[model samples]
Target: MSANKTAMGDIASSTETYPFEKDERYRSQQGLNGFAVKEPFLPNGLGLQVRKRKMVRKRKNVDESPFSVLCAWVVEHQIGLSLNLLLLLSLTHFFFSRARPYTSLFLGMSYYNPKSKKYTQGWEDMYFVATWIIIITGLRVAVMDYILKPIARYGGVNKPKAQVRFAEQGWLFCYYSLFSPLGMYIIYQTKYWFNLREIWTDFPTHTMNGLLKWYYLVQFAFWLQQIFVVNIEEKRKDYWQMFSHHIFTSALMFSSYGYYQTKVGVVILAIMDVVDLLLPLAKMLKYMNFRTACDITFGVFIAVWFVARHVIYMMVCWSMFSEIPHVMKQGCYNSTTGQMISEDGGTAVWWNVMQPFDRPGGTICYNNNIRIAFTALLMALQVLTLIWFGMILRVAYGVLSGKGAEDSRSDDEGEDEEYEEIEYYDDKIKSFDGTNEIVTRTIALPIEEDVNAEEMNLGLRRKSTSPTTASAPRRSTRRTGSARATALSIPGHSDKKDILGRIGCDKPS
Candidate 1:
């Protein structure tokens, strides 16, 4: 009895502090320490699954229902880009020449350029290429390996393939690329028989310039239309969102650009080349993890663009600035046979693309050193902006939509992250219960202290000096103590109880 009073005094005097575990019933309410969360002890007739069945919803607040315009822009961008890569590659052969010592080569034969005094060699066999191989082969693994594949499988990348009824049309991409630079060009001196300077750069050329300027304007206008709708509809997937998709397509285009430039890493970004070849088929087979596939595709796209650009810029200095002439020995008068060879200039795409511009002006600027085209410069600038703007817009949308982080749903859905189903158990799943008297919605959940849940559970099992048990037993123990004293004195108190006539249950007043 003395010990009990001492313990009680200690807990009471320490009023300055209340140990976090002050009650057991409250703990039980949350479910006994932690073996599992207590579902309400449900009676047979009631369960939650019957109550909260899944709901399907259509998107609301989407402002731009005119999807036709967006689709049209997408088609135009793709077609224009494909033509730029295919036409130029088919007509350009400067990269295959081994006479150019810096170029990568696996196999080829030599050809004498009488116009240029040196013997030029060709290297066309592609063997053991490194970076391009990784980009290509890694496509499958990126989509299927680790966590990414699971996430992708959760997405709708798995769908049925429709049969193709017709054969593909040929663009002569491979042939023109191999033969054009080899001096096998069938038309005028080079593939660009329509050089504006040859026809005078004043009227029609100026008109071409206006058309190109309009393409840029229309491209950005589509982006603006998409972003505006995203702002109102609170959707994460919008036209602004679609620009990020360009990372893949642009990478492919630039690889062809690198090939046109004849850089050492011509094949570096080629992973998607094969991806381009096989992704449609893979999607048809339902053999793709969509999230991982897009991610892999995006990563390789970005890497190849940056690395290929890096290699091209670094290699361009030597390949173009070196002073070896095609055939100076033939002399200027005799050299009037084929494309004009100037001894002072370097060889490569830097010359091929820009030579026309310089000849018209009768002056070339070497001040920039590498002689990079203003057009290529503009492209590099835009690519950087594209990446930067995409990231910025994501953060903007998240902040604007009040979703602190961006989550992807269907392309039609806004930027909200799809909520995953909360799992309880796998084998013989124990259903969730709201009325079982333990768990409830968070609005009704009682607040608790931050003690480690594991440590708290350990204390419950040991029961020795458990703070929860100590504080909770006061009333029950007091009732037990008083009951014992009353039983001991009951015989002596009988007269007192009879006088009051209220002590014994069998006695009636």
Candidate 2:
């Protein structure tokens, strides 16, 4: 009895001086401890799969459903999955590419072919391009994870969570670095740069070349992959918003492709992607602990984002709105060379559809409803882009003010540590008898904390501490002298019986 009392006294003394455990929990909750949050305890009804069935024996091997377990695993190991998917798809891509050698995947590929301007796409060609995207993206993820991360670690990049993020951003940097430039190059290859009127002037009869077709296809696949990547990986605060953005963007690409608007599509894509390259790079640098580099890059990214997404994108939208109405009313542009066709009636749909403005009677015909819908969707995209930019500005303000924090808006949601389920052994407390029996508390820490305190702490929030009040048992340990004695005697005292009496429970006589 004396030895146990002495041990309790020692613990009480230590608690009085410095409660390191409590401080650690507080630091982690503030994101200063670099730990994950605790997983929540399963509700009591969780044991009952259905409402009225006999409670089945809980499975020991796997506590969670397969789907949930799979989802959690995928969220933790996105890079590995991306790499695996890339490698597996690459093999399929190789075989398909060989099978469909010299084939064009786009329906508009024949537009530039003067002899036979008939749109065609073999399934093999489509599959090949898809596999190609998966492979390239996979390779990007793998290279960043395996190669770039190791190199960063060698250079003293110690933050594992940051390292994971660095790898994530690395792939984005690579993707935009390669494809954004290619998209621009494709645009430059066209007459759209010199003659903005050419875009809308072609109208419904416009077509895509092999290069333009492939660019749109690649972008479609890229964004599609992003949808999967973002969902399967740790979700951010803006998960649904970003998810919606991907959906809208992907829809735009598809709609534009269907409507044969690759010229404008490529231009918009190039503008958006070129600026996007900087953001991921900046984030990567920040994760690598290169604050100066990150700040510079981020500043540049902000400038570029404003210019590209706002100034230039809005300009393109305005041009489309003003010019397409005029061009559609006038029968304009030739098939082979894209030269202006006279008002007499050219084969291009712009001329053939209706000469509303240039009619003999001067009756102007408005464009079909499809054109209206496309423009509306594009306008909606602009609005969404504006909303996202506002979030970026907030993050930028934090960075510029020397906060040294990542965008709180985009921090991955599940990055914080989760506490493990609270497990109880039947023998620990025996039972609650509603008597003067002393409660012997057994605090069960999370299994994950037991395995690796640091590993589970990666980017996770700290567990909340028990409340400090007389009613709270957590505070009982802090009491000293008479206060401690009083707390210990409360269970047996009639006045303090109010604690159990409040719940309509009475002491066993």
Candidate 3:
């Protein structure tokens, strides 16, 4: 026992004069105590020698130009800047009548009629649409960073990747929750609420109510903002799928509004938004490690997705095929008068279709080409949703197999850390008697803290460390001979598999 204690003391003392002693580069790479080698010299001859290659530390050059600094500041405070701009515009519009027309173009509803209490779709609506995109972007940032992050921390979501995912899901939950109900309300008031055929009855002359118009425009803005968002945020395995979904969705909204199909547009929006609410809820619960809650929410999400996207939404698409051709008259009409012109330069028979007498402009028409384009866009969106549903079914299978749900498409957080190779002797340690000794031993050594200690301090690191075991455990006494031995245990060494398991792999699919 005394010999073993002396051997350990010698090893500890010898580490003080290690070849790379006090070398920051070595310490940074090998950890705080540097590399340790233990060899006890016996009275007889027993020797061991090890060689280590020197490592060079590379420093990154950081750009400190004024332009770079300004750009960094702008990115960091984008939400604040957007809010300030919005405030400035609101104040200008409220205080000055001369600026009202100009600022109202961005801040207020366009082509509004006070007598009828309605809004008309026009090119000028694009100004408000752009402004709302900025507003939604700012609101998303504020809600995620300020509201959801703190909630996630409180709920024990400590990993930086998990926290980010939680915040995203929380923000989406809020948006979808609010808008889903609003969309349903708008649909409830429309004649098409009971009859799907009414969607195309009046065609391009459907009355644009205030609630429906604003809902449609704001929804479009949100989808447009999402395109910028998905590109800026971390890229996932479903990057292209999400990107394409946002593109098709935004284009569909724009086309619907342009063709005066707000009635069907609102219905599709309501159906789509309903399913979105549950998915984010499930993701947020998963991030917080609520296993049961997440599983239950995921099940609900699957049901809603089928009902809303596959059943109800498909019905709307079918209506476009069966009802539109029968109800809508395809011909050139005067936008100024909503009068369908005959080939003889006279007004055609005044059918049951409503005339857009409220709108005065150039001639507009809804032809077969426009109908085909619209149908194709809607089908494209459906196909994207179907692809996502297939992914969901895989998750469901995982759950059934008792693996728990996980998002297979999500990428792992951070890059993998490379591990140094561990060399082994010829299954024996030679003794002073010149005979091979089969020694069973276990040694515990303090591992150097991870380089990202600051991130760990901020709860950004993925591992769950107990308060009592905050730092690495102290070294254990060395043992040799006859007892069964275990391999060296190193804490805080994360490989690619571990990282993937920590972040998205463990999430409910």
Please tell me which predicted candidate would have the highest lDDT against the true structure: 3
Off by over 4 Å in 2: 1-63, 68-125, 330-368, 398-407, 412-414, 420-509
Per-residue alpha-carbon lDDT of candidate 3 for residues 1-509, written as tens digits (9 for 90 to 100): 13432212132222222232232233453332443233433332432221232222122345699987886676678799889989998899989989887998898778887887767777788899989988998999899999999999898888776687789889999999999999999888877886899988764563477777788889999999999888766666578888999999988887677666778888898999988887777667666656566656666777989999999888988988888878877776665446777423223222211223224454556666666777898999999989888866765554444443443455332222233321111112222222343222222222333233223232221221432122322222221111110011113321112111212223422
Query: TM-score for model 3?
Result: 0.68
| lDDT value for model 1 | 0.27
Model 1 lDDT tens row, 286-321: 222233343344345335534434444333323333
TM-score, structure 1 vs. true? 0.25
Give residue 33's error in model 1 in angstroms. 19
Please report, as a residue range, the 10-residue window in candidate 2 with the lowest summed lDDT. Answer: 479-488
Cα lDDT of model 2 overall?
Answer: 0.51
What order do candidates take by lDDT, descending? 3, 2, 1
